[model samples]
Target chain A: MTADTTRRQLLAGGAALGWFCINGSWLQSTPAQAQADGFAPQHLSVAQCSAMNVIADALVPGAHVAGIAAYIDSQLSAKNDSLLLVKYLGVPTTAQSGFYRPALDSCIRLLAADGMTPQLALTAMGEDAVSDWQGPPASFFSFVLRADALDVVYGTEQGFARLDIPYRAHITPKKPW
Target chain B: MSNALSTDTVIVGAGAAGLLLAARLAESGRRVTVLEAGPKRSTDDLISSQIWARRLKWSGPQVEELGDHKVGHAFNAGFGTGGSALHHYGVWLRLHPGDFRVASDHGVGLDWPIDYQTLQPHYDKIQSEVGLSGDADAEIWRPEGAAYPMPPMPLFAQARILQKGFEKTGRRTAPLPLAINSQPYQGRAACQFDGWCDAGCPIGALANPLVTHLPRAQKAGVQFEHNALVSRVLRDPNKAARIRGVEYFQGGERHTITAKDVIIAAFTVQSARILLSSAADTTPAPGNRFDQLGRYLTSHPAATVFGLFDEPTYPHQGVSGGQLLSHDDYDNKQQGNGFGSSQWLIAHAIKPHDLLGYGTGRPDIVGNQLEPWLQDAAQHLANMTLVVEDIAAPNNRVTLSDATDTHGIALARTEHNLDARTARLWQQRIDEGQEIMRAARAREVWHGPRVAMHIMGGTVMGKDEQQSVTDSFGRVHDTDNLYVSGPSLFPSSGAVNPTFTLSAIASRQAEHLITQQ
Candidate 1:
């Protein structure tokens, strides 16, 4: 098959293909099943979420490998008790983030309306390729998306740079009693 | 039931000073109990987008004020066991030696009876226990003190960029001494360097009270009563001079906790409120005889300069306040100006919502056309900002509002009350910061209006009984066994975060209180 044909087929069979995309161990050890896990319902559509993932990857470039979006989504969808970011930064309202989903939906819809797919739209949008998809109001949506991106990229093990990991680099220990 | 909560000492407020004091006291076989007004929070509560955590703040029954700018917000202290420390950005710096004697030196603000040298050892002790990460060797501008316990937190794209500007302009930028682990130490993990510290850390990496000190205090059998709002300090009929106990309300129940001594670890604002609320009957009037309880209050009004860069600074990679600092030029109090010293907190990676949005004074903007800007901001996280300090003014005080609430306690009234001299001082620092940013090859440079920082100088510590409310050791002049801790003891709002100095002061007071007992 041609590259475009295969791409279309992959897109059409995304649910099946996504099975391999998720590491089996991670799926099994999902936070939902963890004793401390408080789960929130996933409210967005596949198309909308795929758009967010693509845009987030473009925002940080290395975010997917860093597993940032998953982390952001986890914190966003987890039980209020399980999510720590809300408590620390005082995100104003914990019941609703007020920015994440609506911003994601707007970006996807605007980009899609301009005759671009989710992935291509995000990459093109970065280069200022699509003029019509100006994203959210100048600073507000930018703030939410930037925080979400960082929540994923920097909040993760790779993101925190594993510097916090004990037994890795021992330095200047306190005198024991 | 009394046996359920027994301790040699009970510390109120669970911020940096209280937590450190509790840990140190607990180490010496003292059973310590900390009563916090906020909720009981942990790292797990930090990462969620939940609403309750954000609602953890001090909102008296109702607030009535007359000013364009309302001083007290609904959420002031974190409504958890950790207190406001849960939301603090871990930028740890000692107040300058001169900061201790502001009135004596410049004749501008009230003078602290004790000098910085007196608090130096405590600074060292807290730094050692907390594990500060910074390049002590490079901080030539820093005053005499023991070196930081750990190497500096790694400089990111923004620090490197900002350093170049400082070099180009003949200015200086050193690694900010942070109470975050650069490498694993003290049985706790180091900073993950996620820059999400303002949001709280989940892995117990940052030296927040809950993770670092409170846990140890608990291990040493320190009992904590969360969600307890202390209403007033009740005195006995016989020794109306000495505090008998504290009257508090929790879960809609009015209860009294008797103690030999009462330590007000509540923050400057709340501490002043509690004093004002109780002194209504005890002192024959609110802010009675001395007129010193909450009159000379001041919070270091800070301004920030943001510099945008083309490179991917990844500002979100490190601490919320960033890695590098600029105090070499700003630390000196300008001559002939009534302003005290001012310092620079650089490369702070602000979140788009609060940091970039509300902080920049543009909280209203929302809707479409935001994604592209965010895409750019994510890559350019390496931008820099300067937390320029403002001078102390007595008029910049916290007062009890005449308007009473459902609970009958008065609300906190505040006015920005900045002086012309301090306003000029802010302008000078902003100009210098702008020049530094321009030298660094920034595409755009802008500064935010001055915003208030860690509380200061309401119930100041002094030598003379007539001038101040508390003595140098934080003991009330007339009332025995009533001690105050934290920034409320600050004689001046020096141009630095008060957490470190407050810790040192609290430690000193705790030693005195222990001996006096």
Candidate 2:
């Protein structure tokens, strides 16, 4: 068969599972479960993860447990196939890391300088009042990250049950992320 | 390109129009080949999760946008086998008779080459083929057409409660016409009211291309090449008047497919992008001699109104398109401050999260304040969307961006802006929608920011080359065997979902092609 045929087959045959690298092996797990299991992210540094978790958990409670860092990391690794809503907003997959890495540094800077809480920094970011903030407008980045947090925390079947709505899925998703 | 491919006809894009045309032409004994930019997909791939549904949206190229109103190409365009119709809410509405002559009557926008009467038979034929469900008589504003084949989908608690607002406001409500099967028909099962339409109905109930034309094309021996990103339509070197096939990138290699006929059905932006990229040094692109290839682009200016009533509305109990519709203000485009047609899709099935979710609309409720508010809105929220017609303008267009893809072809850049009249109409409808929500005894009411709904025009059809890129039959004016299909050929932006009208146009094109062949 042709190489193009093989590539098409690979893409079409993707398993409906989010495989995380945990304890030196690949395991199918939700973003939250991957976080709880100490899965190593293929992308994102430890500092970036810490900053993302703090900021996301502050935006939507339980986002840290839901693994917003792991979710964003996994999506970024997928390149053009990334399911992040930022794709709809005109951010190219190749430039996605450029968007996250720098804004995350801004958050790190704010947290380190004033001993400010994550909530305070997030409010400032939302208001576009962060001093010396960099990369994608602070408010826009907050909107995107907040959407990412909501996806991992309440965009799944289990999340629906928490809100007292029936998860009447015609084809239930295999992964939560 | 050593191993060149050849076919009697080469169809670009495996979306609704291409698949329908493929099945019809292949059945007429033509050797047809379809190239899809996205991966191969089946019903099993349609997972019922809002986050998972994002996989169905455009992932091929980044479309840079600029304007007061930008068409949400990535959100509205689709990928994979079934295309955007897979994620569509199945609101299959027909254009009104008055919608055909906006330029001739209102002195704004471009009028369609053909009137609604010429297209009505095809609309009826597509409905019969796809099995639509609606109460035709109840739709007081409906244009002339055949009655739906199946009875309307049943109303739920949310729809019943929302109808009272229309009653009190002296407005009218009708069963929303849908392409979904309300009862078992044509071997497809009935809808189960699972609220998973946008996630794609996997049970063959909703008339997605998967259940409609894809299988028929497969049965008719139409060969499909997945993950083939087409760059441009090639010109026939020996004969300048005739058109050749296409060049595409697949499997990290460039390939060429030569055919007697070529059709571009790559939705709106990409269709215009391909034509713009086809311009070789001296010979302007096919159908672009007058620089009218991507002009007159349009999108419906739409927004959603949400309210939390005291009683349980059970907002998540029906199909995503909503259970009822209001077209009381549809016939009058110049009503109040607005100068365009508008309609309301009422009582849609909703969830607690995702972009259109009520909880997400209220970004102020966060941290500990979120879950409780989400839980309350999940059961008690009532919502509806206002879709206003946009007047097509020459300035709104799709052009080639300076940025190039891996294949070195310029990417698409679109700029679409609303006319002052359309914006005013949208605001008027939004305010009226809020009033109706309050009239329904909603304790709290709010509306989402105005957003772009359906994308259309770009490579619109008209009488001649100076007016548009194609004729009424979608044939490129300068070429003998070049054509375009889908909503890209629309000359006006009617205030309704476009899938049904696009399918009808496809049906007409298929018949014309077959009879001519």
Candidate 3:
């Protein structure tokens, strides 16, 4: 085999988990188990993962099934090789987790407060209405979460197919980016 | 001579400009060596994934950015062999005559040391050599030059839909001049239109340095040392006016490579950084005699307007750089609330995710409403980008950061703030862009955030030594052999993609250098 083919194979092998998620096995795990042990997050705590899932689901439903937290965790784990949308916004790869961690913690804390619904929480974030919003602007955090949710939901070949968009490939990616 | 490490010309950065210079100089029998900070890259490395493409972007030392609008260095610059041009959308365009003399005519921004007439021949030569595709006659607002070497790529349905908006608004549009091939040319294949231009076109369709200049340079025996991060330009201790060579890090070891001439074409920020870092205890940096090394830094303020048409627009059918161009407002630099030029690049082939992606644009869209909206918009969405010129201000500059990289070289820091006039122009164009989309029979229309596109003018070229880092030929005013190239030499940020203009400038510099040699 050629070196190019071998390289592609290695890359594809390395990205098998992402491919599995893209192929819809991401929905197999229940939310509780997924947050618990189905896929252990390297960067986020279980509570933080749960919070991310909740917030991401509110931003883009099916995000839990689409494995938004797992996707984000996987990206965060990759560090400089991350595919997270926040990378494009001038956030250094080294500081990406820092950008996410406290924001998710703050979100979790806000959601746990008395009588706070997901929709209301999201609305408050959109309006920047959170009084004690911590770690990056709440509006900015919401925007990032929404973008991340979109990635898991609609940034794949199957995802494109669902949208009726042709997944035309000059060189079809063996795995989702 | 063979045993010695020194070369005739040593270029820091194996980017478009550097590679072009290397190939030309090497072909003329001058030994050329290029030092690239990033890893070696071939076309095989360009995987068709945006996530993988991140590897192509600037992953070197983090640039500390400050200002209302940061230069977006991380997004705009590139790493490895081909540099930022590796992931560039191939929208090759010429600067208008007015673009060359912004200060002389409008009493704003710095004027280029050379006029359009001086660079026209070089543009013509580069266009012929590189092979651009467009209908030059149809480009009503184009400055005079030779016709495009190839016919324009066929417009997709999305472009046709957007063209209606231009017609209705009494504005005109022509096919966008692209460095990508319409048909096979010079053995390179035509573009596949997969809308993955930002991923670094692997098919050799886009005229990146890998496909265009790098190979030629290699064939001409131009030596390239990858992962060689240049720290500073070294000067002869006795002769302060002469540049001796450069100090660089390769394989975790510091090395010095001497040359007769040194060319710093390391994109905008790093180029300026290297010069700023070269400051010694006895003398200032090579081109910082007047503290003008990194002044007048500029990035075009750009925004995208998206519209969901009633008809099946099929937005994914063209290249990422878009299919059509409208320069109707480009010539009129001072218009309405703005003091600079603006143009519309219509019908870009978009993706579902990433920053400019259709999915990312609609943050308000999500939940159950997301799928149907995406599906419909995938087929019917038409989008166009408005590129507004930025005025070159002395306050907008690149400086050396206090923070040092692993190699102990001070990291580059950039500060770029848009002039109120430029911001006003961007807002006005965005408003007009939405109106055009509405006129095109769109049911829904929206615009994206105003962001920096192409970067330019950190080491600006001008006639006056006191006001600029380089002279008309891109030679540092104080240093005899040290020079700068690339978009960083621009005195004014024109409302056009800079690759064509920068390549032409490099070509002009090449001729001047060869003649002088």
Candidate 4:
């Protein structure tokens, strides 16, 4: 077989369970037992990630456990056309980037300015960002962080469960609804 | 490339319709050449997961918009030969008979010149060729069509639970007819019933364009040139009309393909943008004098409702998005409601990776609290999405933006407004759905933040050339030798997915283009 064919086979095998469920090709697992394999990260600093995890769990409970963080991180690492190309270079490509870092720093700066702890200021900024779409809300920092986080935390898999959401998957049987 | 390699037909957008048309044309011994904006992808090059399928994502330069919602432009189009069909869930449903002639019945929304019966034969033919899996006998509510080639997929626990709830609520649900293979026909393998199809099915079981039609087209001596981003249709000064080929950007350089007949199969927004932008380049005065080119853009208002079941729903065990469909109210389009009709696509297989991306009522879950919910919800991931019908409105349109790209091409600007009538319909159906969930004994019920589903209807087809971009058979009304296809031809957005119908219409167009000549 060609290298591409071999690679395709490997991915197909690895994602066999997903393929079966998505395409109706084979029965990968029963509805009950298949929950354990939800994507998760292996190398995350569990302690550092704990705060984000806790917030995510409460927002969409089952999704956090389903490895949404891992998934988010994975998606984040991949480059796309939408990526603010300069962000990865650790340089300011857009004016928003210049404002973003300072806003985060200001959260700490405000605490320092007011004689409050740096950690406490960070927590405060996080809280303010989540509750309202107003204020500087960490200026541009809030937009990037919240947008990226929402892309993961409140996305297709985890978001649905958190809201107890469902889709109308069928149209013919005329079920109870 | 040699100029001598010109063909009788040059098709833009090597997507499902274009590929299928090319294959059929080549089989008839006609020279067919396809130009795709994205990279070429063969069956072997197809990846198994959404994460690995990054190349399929559209890489169009940034666009500017005035609304709270942009088209999510860059991410919408697929950047490969198979186009969006590569990542599509393969949900195939025909437009209801009532969908056409809406202006007569409802006194609003543009009416389609050709009725559902006209498209029915083509739908049946495409379904057979593509091998649709469903029980036509079971779909009594479905429009007239031939039987599905394969049997209905087995119901998983999530669908079963939703069915029970829907049944309890006195709602009607049917098995979702999907392009996904159930038992495998047309020499393709049967589906393994895993839920990772949004990532592009690696196995040939799911009918992605790469696996099904493009290969056949290639085998028929159809030439496919990828990464050829057509900038515009260049025309000559001759008053008669000059079909002088398409100008595109390829490999950091500009290239042109001279052809006799050109078909623009780019998806809705892009297709209209191409014409509008090209008109600006070639014919500055074209104005919306046709009064139709970029008007009446519509998309299904897609919303999701999630219910937590007590039992293990195992949402990840079945087809990506096929099982039960709620059509009890599909044909119930009231004139003033703005909302036409709606359908339910249930038990959508949700992978842990991409599920949370759809911001619904779901709050973010993080840290310690998430694990238990995952453990509990994984077994009971019974989710359903509501696809509401949106009528073509002049206000909801795809317009040209002032923002020019690096190549100096004008970007597409879109403006979408939801009428109060449509909003009321959405609220009513969602409320009803919540009641159904309660009847199903769901522990909780939540709805998705209403967002645009499938983008369509910008460049529409109609009988009157003055009011529509293309004719009934998708032939451009202005240009004699130019044709356009895809969901852009939809005069009115139906309650169901448009892929199946798009394929059917494309088939009809291809046949018309070949035979009429």
Candidate 5:
């Protein structure tokens, strides 16, 4: 094919190619199915994922269905290719796991105590009232988690539609996150 | 070590400025070679996904940042061929006439060695060449320049709603001058208003260096070396007056290249990093004779105000840079309790994710309330960003980091703190922004944190060698052959986007270089 023809094809096939590339091994197991069937996170532990899910669901309802834990895990696993907004805020790619791991661990420990609801836990985080919390900062961690929750819950076309907004895409995404 | 190569001109950082200069110089029959620290990218790589677009951002050596207002280096800079312009929102605005004489007019901030009149011809030339779309006459705050080649982009529902707010507040607004094509121009397709500009414009609708300058440079026979991180500029051992070439790392090996002239166009921090790292045992870095190599770093303090209007306004129907602009408060540098200029970019096309995303804006609305709040905002949200000019404090600077990268080169360490007056100006504008939002009959209004945007200075241009690193023509004050291009040469932060001004400076520099040769 001519260069012009190839360029046109690439432009037309951009979304499809991106979808396949991102899905890679997860194509067979949709985000919903993975969440339903107890998705195995590659980088995060079970407890870490559990805490992330609870906190994310608290920050953004339907985040569990949107696969917030899976999204964070996938992005963290990508390392340098991470789409986490924290990358734009000073935290380097090499130290990205360091930023998330300890914070999630702190969340798990904090929530493991009796009668700790996601709302109360988040409130405590906002107030820096969590005892023995071992991550960056309770308030900052909550902010970052809240941002991540938003990403998975409303960063896609279907997500936009869920909020009654039009996904007027020049090049449409093949699948929602 | 790899065998040394030679070229007529060696330009570090294949960014907007670098590519533009390379194209012009090569077209004028001078051999040019550009060394880029990141990978090579094409329009094909410019996907619509924000996650995938992260690949376009700066992923090189970490820049250690300190101070109250740390420049968002990684966020503001791009990685590959097009540099930061790859993902830029294409808000092409020229600096005002008063902006060039900040110190003289307002008795605050440094003044530009060259005035707006000196750069006006180049601005007009670049606008014609690159094709900016806007109603030039409507920009009452604009400096004198040629009329825009194309008419302004059509106002979306969000913009129309926000324009009412500006009108109600008795402030004037004009269609934001954008490098984005409003209609098919110079064979490129018109913009689709996809609002995926941060992901890079795959189509040639946005005039990024990928489509605008890189291709022209290639056509003009300018050579490019991607994944080539230039460590430092080399000087002749015998002659202290002249530069020999540059040392770089590629494919896990060190290499050297000799050139007649060297231009460091790496976006702000890294460009400063290269010069600061070049200090030898006997001699200081090329332009550090007066100990002013990495001084006078500045970044615009910016924030966004979001409001929920009763009207159904689709906020995602335009470019990310915004649909309209209000510069009514821009020229008045000495406004109440503050001493700097400020402008409002109204009704930007917003996303749900990322830093400026609408969903990310309200952290308080959570749990069961999250969905409803997001749903309301998705339709009714109208937002505007306030860009406040930062004073060029000498202490706010870029220094060499004690820590070294794997390649054994010291990383760039940036220290930037906003002046008290500048902070007051930011707060003042943000307060007025909410008032304007409420005047438009909004139910709720809130603002984002004050963060730095569009970094400038570090190797500032001035007439005095002791006060600046480069001359008005971007030539290093002390060195004859060494030049610094891009926003790093800016003497002041002018409450406007720096791309147009930087491009014009590069265009002027290209002319000077060709003439000198």
Candidate 6:
């Protein structure tokens, strides 16, 4: 696919694919496709992405398959054009990744030290009970991460259909992002 | 740098106010150019999905916000061609008569330089031009004005259910005054009641700038430059009181647009940010003689009341701004343990997700309980919002931040804390809202946390030079041919939405500017 596609062409592809930098090549892919192909993140490290996927998926059951981590990674890398929920929380474009990196690492630390299940760690994080928890308040981070998870899982036409709501489109979004 | 572009008038931001001003000025045989900070977009870009609606919000320089309220600048401000109005819910309401005399009547907040009578004509004009759907006679609290251009939007099941609660509580409800087409008006399609209004009304039913002033501006030959982030108004060094257009950055390159008159209509925060940044070494910013350029910032303290009913309400069947309005306590500012006016916007069409959604508000519900709860709420939920008036406090202001953007221009930092009375009033009204929900016979009723909605003030208009940044006409106090428009000129936030009021002010300003031309 071309690097830039018109709205018609994108919609013609039935749910457009965002241009992502995987490995060294730029390819058109969705977050789900990116996660399945093990697409390398340009901004976040592999370990960080793995850790985030675990917590985010735990927060929303289908988030892992829906590519919550990849969605966040892609949005963070998009800089000023990011569609992350954190933007609505007043997180600056330059400091968006700064919010996610330490928070995800804390989840990694919680799993390593306490050997707690993803569900348990999520409960602890939501309550701000995790010891040595880092990055934006733990509870706040959980809310934001869960919001990100929700977006990927239930913020699209298919997501709306899952709840049996009408996906009435005046102008449908070419890409989920 | 290319040679400076020249125009009779240069308006910053292509939002509602800017487009209205551009169209009015350009049609009167003047060259008007508008500079927008974000990407170019049209009705085709207004996707039905809420996720895509994020693109309509502010994407310019980072505005660091502080204090209890913090203005929620990131969420409230907008980007791109149509600006924030593209994503706004079409809840257009006029300010109450008491709103103009905040200082005289209540001894709190600044008074508007002009009274409702001065703006009454403009309000009537804009309403007639754009067509507002409402029952004028039903809104008994509405001040003397012409009837709405179109009939009110239909009350869906959700709205009818919510109205019963208000009626049971002895509060009267009327169809909401919205700048949306009830039927085809002026060649625009009527609202589809699809609940995608927050995602920009693509069908031209909602009076977004695209279907309103923008088309007029385009037809009148107004030039628009997208991705042009204006830094500050360029004041002529030789004549300190006169402006020489504006300086903006486009595609990493600084450019100048010299205009006969310069209008800063970049919403609330950025409008103040531009003027605050325009301070000269010898002279302070044009209207900052008394350090009042960015003062008196205010936002309505609002919250949503959610309830789950036994009957299917078809929660996703109406506009996002709700279907009905109640101002039963609007005239009595000091009634019911509250100091300011409060109104109810009842029965907003809803979704299962998004920031303002019921599911998102219930962060505690998770695991297997989520999907079932969402499905249940989607079919049976009803919601209404309580909007309380905001008193303009001097301390709550927008100033230049320590931070700078890529072009070395100082970013905006807003500190907005709700007045004690306003906060109390919000709590009182929200509590009342909960009771109304239950009175309507809902099994359970809950309310969301107090939030900042529809930003206003910042560069407020007043008669006194030392007390205000601009005159009643929105011209900066000490500057010639330099003005500020939009919600930034509002001196007080009435317990109603600001779009109708701001658009009226723009019309008034446009007429004044055209007369000067």
Best by DockQ: 6
Instruction: Write candidate 6's Cα lDDT for A52-148 as tens digits.
Output: 8888777776676676777888888889878877788889777898999999888889888656898888788888998998899888998888888
Model 1 agreement with the true structure over A56-95: per-residue lDDT tens digits: 5555433334333444455555444323233323242343
Model 1 CA deviation exceeding 4 Å by range: A1-177, B1-8, B48-76, B280-288, B335-338, B357-369, B404-406
User: Of the candidates numbered 1 and 4, which has the greater DockQ value?
Assistant: 4
Model 4 over residues B133-231: C-alpha lDDT tens digits? Answer: 888877768888888888988898888888988888877788899898888677888887777676677677778898888878889999888877777
On residues B1-517, what C-alpha lDDT tens digit does candidate 2 reach at each position?
5588999999999988999999999999999999999999999988898888888998887888999998988889999898888899999999998889988888888899999999999999999998899999999999999899999999998888889998999999999999889999899999999898988889989999999999899999999999999999999988766888899999989999999889999999999998899999999988889989999999999999999988999999999999899998887877766699999999999877777877778877778788778888988999999999989899999999999988899999999888998888888889999999999989999999899998999889999679799988888889898989999999998899999888888888888888888
Clashes of 2: 0
- The CAPRI quality class of candidate 6 comes to medium
Q: Tens digits of per-residue lDDT for model 1 on B1-517?
A: 1322334566678777778777777776777777877677766666521122343444334333333222333334555666677767778888777777666766677777887788898888888877788887888878788999899888778788888988998877789999888898888787776656655666667777878788878787777887777777776668766777676667776766777777788887777777777774445322235677776666665667767788767665667766788787555676355355677777765544333431222322122223334445555644455444445555666678886644556766655566677766777778888888888888877777665556566677888765677888887776877777888778777777877888788778767766765
Chain B TM-score against the true chain B, each candidate: 0.92, 0.99, 0.98, 0.95, 0.99, 0.99
lDDT, model 6, position B375: 82
Q: Which parts of model 3 are misplaced by more than 4 Å? A: A1-15, A18-37, B1-4
When candidate 1 is compared with the true two-chain complex, its DockQ is 0.04
Clashing residue pairs in candidate 3, if any?
none
lDDT of 4 at B461: 89
Q: Per DockQ, what order, best first? A: 6, 2, 3, 5, 4, 1
Cα TM-score per model: 0.73, 0.96, 0.94, 0.80, 0.95, 0.96
Best-to-worst order by TM-score is 6, 2, 5, 3, 4, 1
Clash pairs detected, candidate 5: none
| Candidate that would win on lDDT | 2
Off by over 4 Å in 4: A1-177, B1-5, B44-46, B53-55, B65-71, B280-288, B335-338, B355-361
Give the total clashing residue pairs for model 5: 0
